[model samples]
Target: METDGGERSISGSSYKRQDEKFKSVRRVFRIMDLVSERGEDLTAKQLAREIGTNLSSCYYLLGLLVDEGYIERVSQGGGYRIGPALPSLHQGKPRSDFDARIEPAVKELAHRTQRHAYAAVLWDGEVVVTQVKSPPRSPPVGVVKGFHGASHALALGKVLLASQGAEFVDGYIDDYGLEAFTPRTIVRPAELHAQLNKVRMVGVGADFEEFARNLCCVAAPIYSASGKVEGAIGLSTTTRRIRDEGQRMTSTVQRAAAEASTLLSDEPDIKDGKNRKSG
Candidate 1:
């Protein structure tokens, strides 16, 4: 009898542990579903309330998702969004060929400008650097591939953000709270909105030491065949260099972005010809 009772006790404990684990897994999925439905508008506190869990547990789950690239925060103290890895899992493909086409343009831009040039895209509600090229003997500009967050402080980021419209920008500012990276960073909603309006009007975005002291950048939008803003290409250099040659560099970057856009528009024709040859 004693042996049988001990066996039953252990079995009951094992079942309880399994039930708890299942509940935790369900909570994770629920969180993902909420973020997907809301689209970069669900903060951690809101998620905790919706999931019927404590804030600590919600944060722990959010941390796990972020570390695994299943979800990402829009910015520090901001809401959540679906991340790059989740869609890749569904499609089982590499980075888009459009990004591949942008790489050569970035390289040429770097050579022409003698500065660090990069391409960025709005991926899953985040500004993601897709490619970067640095001219020989150029100083480090402190950006690289896969760099994200702080979109309001970057020229590339502003181009992408401005394309998304005022409502989205308002939601972003409400959720992300405009972190001031430098004294020049636009921390006020009205000022940021005005700057974004100018970006829309001028077809260019410039960051004058807004992200970091002594660093400057300028970007232009890259359009898709559908006439949608798909990405941006930009050049980064010293503040003095930007002040001295801003107009020239701006034109160079805009021309490079236009060329990249043309290449992207031609990609489908190129792919169709290849398919015909294969057939």
Candidate 2:
């Protein structure tokens, strides 16, 4: 009887450890899922609150994930978002629905504008180009692969930022300090707010040598079916050339974005907090 009881005690101890391991695994996945679904980053404290974990444990886990490249720290950049490694895990999956619906419109915009067109999404407080189309005669645009940090410096970034509302913009300003990319860049908070207001009013954002010398672009917001801004579509060209075709460029880009907006599942406008007409 003593031998049997001893064996049972050991087995119970082993089972308890296994159960704790399972719970830890579950907690990690829960963190990942919440961050991914939010379409933005979360601070360690915010994540802890959401996940119902103590701050110490949450911070430890978040740090581990960051070291492993499963989550990224956005201290000056923004917040903690899914790490670059996460995308590779989905490499074998088929193209996303956003790609399918937005690509055709992007191509049409490029053809119509006779310039470069691209689709960008606001991920972790940065503008990330997700798709691109360029006129056959145009040279390759080297800006597609990276995220744009200076939201106030680029047309697409500005439009995406403007659609997010005041509170979001404030957090963004805090995450990515506004630094002048060029003399034309809006670095002051009040100045940037005014420009963002114009972007909202016009339904288009403009950049003229703000991000870089000799470069200009115009962007329009793409709304999800629920009416929230999902991303933006932009057309790019040399500043001198775009100056001559400014009105036409804005028209084509806005039209393309309006078409793309229909493809999303939601269309909730973050501005008035209602679903307004895409027009």
Please give the clash total of every predicted structure, in order: 0, 12
Q: TM-score, each model?
A: 0.65, 0.62
Assess candidate 2 and give its lDDT: 0.74
Give the whole-model CA lDDT for all candidates, comma-separated. Answer: 0.79, 0.74
lDDT of 2 at 23: 73
Candidate 2, residues 31-51: lDDT per residue as tens digits? 888766662556777888887
Instruction: Output candidate 1 Cα RMSD.
Output: 10.0
**Residue 204: error of model 2 in Å?**
0.5
Q: Tens digit of lDDT per residue, candidate 1, span 73-183?
A: 775448877765564444334335666777788899988877899988765455677677888876556566656667899999899989988877877676567999999
| Model 2 lDDT at residue 17 | 97
lDDT of 2 at 213: 89
